[model samples]
Target: MATDIPSPDARPARSGRRSGDSTTRTDILVAARTLFGENGFTKTSMRAIAAEAGVDVALVSYHFGNKRGLFSAVMEIPGDPVLRVTTAAAGPREDLGRRLITTFITLWENDDTGVALRAMLRSAVNDEGAATAFGDFASGAMMPAIATTTGLSTETVRAIGSCIFGLAVMRYLIRAEAFTALTTDDVIEQFGPRLQAIVDADT
Candidate 1:
């Protein structure tokens, strides 16, 4: 069954300035991130963000032009994942796994990236459009490139992608004790080789 997708304009209450002023813009982004992370993108609204940031609704339009733009800003992710993956995947196939894992971890460890990811995940759960956005990013950016570089099948590549998503969910969102507390090095040491195996699998 098709679900009702929440518009960005339908969000809950927020705590700050209105949207257009420099301070308000910054405030809106910050509030939007928190709400988006907590409630999923579909459920978050420009009105709520404006309220949270103490700004007017029109200012949101003036500053971001729309909810998607606000989402992009909150995510803080660079160009589309496809471009990012293509650029990052430009080395020897054998080194692709390690490089990918390393780069991904580094990006996630950053506070901004972590918050962005949280928002993305939340959005994915509530909105098909958001899920499509994420899928395009994963497929166009990461999976195909990994498959091409490492000669893995599409399914295998997707499995590796699943692993990455699972890891993030367990470690960050769920805060699984061991996964959460592990030092970055500990995680890489344990999961890196497994990810490589998936990428280089015989299937």
Candidate 2:
């Protein structure tokens, strides 16, 4: 009879590989985000992301199709707040502020949203196209609805938009310790009325 035994390192190596595939995908995204933030979308390439991630170029395409798709995935956040707010606002003008703030806060509390938000802030700082896209999404979709509900002029609506976006920046992007550390209820308490004030302001 003959007995064979695997090396001590073999089991650990195999165990590491059990999650290697998924970890590779995550690595690609992280590398992509860093590259995109540093170089902007136009200059950052699939090849570069793969190189940074230490993965094959084919893996990038296989997972995300192209740069745009990969960027979209990297930018995806939890809760479709844009859609939800638009849908909810379609029915009536009243209750818009509360609903919008509630939805926005709920979404921001999630990990996915935090990841997307960090990417968005970095991209906006580095990429002109990303800044334009973010601005358009805010003014076209969110601001107009809030303006309609509150009967504010476009300029006032935009001012309110700035305030809301500023809060996100201060809290998340800048990681203003005070703002970031605030509990959900504390955030609502501090900003809820102010947000309502913006919506209800006469301009």
Candidate 3:
């Protein structure tokens, strides 16, 4: 009978594979975000991101499809717009305005979400695709959700989107003096009721 002994340095292949996969994906995202911030999206390519991540270029495509998908991943908005809107909708219909505003505020204040949001917004001004992407998500996903929740018409939903977008612009984008002077609670208390009235007025 012959006995075989494994080498001392040998380890489980599966565990090593799992660790590498996790680390690689995270590295790609970090690299992409850094480069996107420094050079903007169009200037950054898969190869650049791959080099920064110390991985093969194919791996970028494997994980994130293309720059658009990768940028979307980097944005990492919490629960996605659809999920967030649906969640806000689940609460009291009468409370939908306040809940939705609070939800938007929370998304805007969180570190990761807020950073990506501001980046996307800033880029959108010069980049049509970015503008369309953000606009579509806001108008397409969120508007309908609010309309459905409050039983409001399409026009009313646009009004709701306008208000929320303006709020984000004032607080996150421009940091307007008049809006910045007020606290989050103050904005919520003052503006929230007016939003509620829009929903309430719809038949």
Candidate 4:
């Protein structure tokens, strides 16, 4: 009789999963992305996202590990954005705008995460909730880092962020004739100094 036992510890965890987990995970991602876009990661709560997704906070934690992890999962960011900005911030202060804008645009244009972001932005235009979310992340999360990196004040950052947002909406989202007529390089040349001025003002 001593030869017949397998411990619970020895069992595979995956064997215990319900078929509904896939749907739950997707639900969590959708809800988290919306909340994060609207309120930013620092302000959105796991409980709030879970409640929006019709799940428990425990399930959200189990799926994404933590708030930071949830944000990364929602955005499909390759690395922590703070670190990404810090690394990109390293070099001449003069080149900061070009570097930052180029990097930011590249991420939004990439095939993998960019595709998801594009779809989300399209949805955002027609939906108030989506627009709130997009606005929150862009102004709250994205601008702060650029402000820090450029030694600019928060107010200046907001000004710079507005310019970038307009560029994004015109070029990528709305496909406005004015922005679309200019090449990426042309935009960078024309607008990069406007961004650089915020940093220059600080110095």
lDDT of candidates 1 onward, in order: 0.67, 0.63, 0.68, 0.67
> How many clashing pairs per prediction, in order?
14, 0, 0, 2
Q: Estimate each model's TM-score.
A: 0.57, 0.55, 0.62, 0.69
Model 1 agreement with the true structure over 1-203: per-residue lDDT tens digits: 01123354555444443335557778778877766666565456677777667767777778776765676666555434444555666777666667767766776787766677676677766766556545554554457766776667889878878887888888767779978888878777777788777666655
Task: Note each model's CA RMSD in angstroms.
Answer: 8.2, 13.8, 12.4, 10.0
Could you give the candidate ranking by lDDT, starting with the highest? 3, 4, 1, 2
Summing lDDT over every window of 10 consecutive residues in candidate 1, give the lowest-scoring window.
1-10
Off by over 4 Å in 2: 1-74, 77-81, 88-95, 149-151
- In terms of lDDT, which candidate is strongest? 3
> Which residue pairs show collisions in model 4?
37-133, 38-133
Q: Which tens-of-lDDT digit does each residue in 1-203 have in candidate 4?
A: 21122222221222233334669899879877766666655567776676667765678778777766677666555556666765766679887777767766766667875676566657668877656755666666667776677677788777766776678788889889998898767877878787777667764
Could you tell which candidate, 3 or 4, scores higher by TM-score? 4
The TM-score measured for candidate 2 stands at 0.55
Clashes of 4: 2
